[model samples]
Target: MEHKPLDQLRSVADVQPRPLSREERLQRWIDLLETDPKRRLSSLGEIEYKPPAERALLREDDSPLTVAYEDPVLRADGLSSDRLGDAMRYFALSDGQAHYALCSCLSGRTMEAGTCAQRLRNATGNVAWESAVGAWLLAALAVSLPGLVYLLS
Candidate 1:
């Protein structure tokens, strides 16, 4: 007689192992999320997360928290230190276009600030009334500027 492997000796499916129930499957998924440090929710409590390398790495000196604390650039847009982390996390989960917009905004490109912020807002679905109002105001000014100058001159 020759000794054979267990798999060859018997079909394990014949033993009828228990299939996972719906609740068990759900629990297992929850457990996996809870136990996985990388998958686990951060203080922001968002399910989607990015690894540190993927997130914007602002140095202490360049951090908006420190250098921009008093600057109104980010603050004026309601992105203070308190909400900055959440925005960065959002950017991490968003597309490259949003990330580029955020980078432009954070890197002090004032000319593109409003557009960049709008892009970020669009990505996060948190467009503010003030931003809309400002856009209208700017548009009105732009449309009226040439006529106003012509009238005055």
Candidate 2:
């Protein structure tokens, strides 16, 4: 008999998660600016922007969910050459919010309940979430220009 099942299991084991450094993280974000559906959806979601606590903050009411922004698009700029598209993409959800953010950009960030951290009234722009998102999209666009032409054209 063939060891096909064993081979499949071995393939799964061979797949590994790549570790991303801080610099790499920002670069990745900028790079993703051009394309990515999840990103696009998120940028659109920005129109419906709500307070951080009301929107994308982790909960403590036994839900154990980490409310964080999610970019679930291949090209998440919302649209090509659109200024608003270039604004930034975000989606606040819950649990395992393993997203790329920098200390300087995300500095002074706090967790809140009953509302979004963004709308906490005390929440301020110590963190550079918008900047971070901008950086990532720019990078992504630079590297994927040819593809962009093919897409938008």
Candidate 3:
């Protein structure tokens, strides 16, 4: 007589599996589809995250975030502190075409920073906080010029 596996022949209560309810499954999916994106600035790397969730894309899984063919928000250029020199050059030499851009379209305001910033904003994305360093530079120039003229003349 051949000996069959105990699990196959006998009713062995070892593994227990439970299915999810329709509502629970639906909620799981809704959690996955919703994405929360934020921008971080520093000497570290920048990346978009789907974050941790208990849901998926559908009523089953979370959908992967899509990157546009020309997504400015997802600029892969070097954002490390080492790249600061290049970024400075970009700010000085170019009007604004090397840095990245970050904007919040829903805010009804748009940020016009550097090329890098623009890239962060998807090139077409709008931002609620529009900060420009150029204006400050111009203001500094104006503020100091009068003093220089007084001293020289």
Badly placed stretches (over 4 Å) of model 3 are 1-64, 67-119, 122-131
Q: Least accurate stretch of 10 residues (summed lDDT) in model 1?
A: 39-48
Q: Top model by lDDT, which number?
A: 1
Residues 1-153 of candidate 3 have per-residue lDDT tens digits of: 986676765575454334444333322322322222332222111211222131111110111112111223222322112132332232221212112231122222322222223353333223323334566778999999999999999
lDDT of each: 0.40, 0.32, 0.30
Candidates arranged by TM-score, highest first: 1, 3, 2
Higher-TM-score candidate of 2 and 3: 3
Residue 18 alpha-carbon offset, candidate 3, angstroms: 44
Predicted structure with the largest TM-score when compared to the true one: 1
- Looking at model 3, report the run of 10 residues with the lowest lDDT sum: 54-63
Q: How accurate is candidate 2 locally (lDDT)?
A: 0.32
Q: Model 3 reaches what TM-score against the true structure?
A: 0.23
Residue lDDT tens for model 2, 1-153 = 545665687767774345444334333334443232122121112223445443333222211011121333312322122222121222221211222121112222322222222222122232557778899999998989988899998
Ranking 1 against 3 by lDDT, winner: 1
- lDDT at 132, model 3: 47
Position 135, candidate 3: lDDT = 68
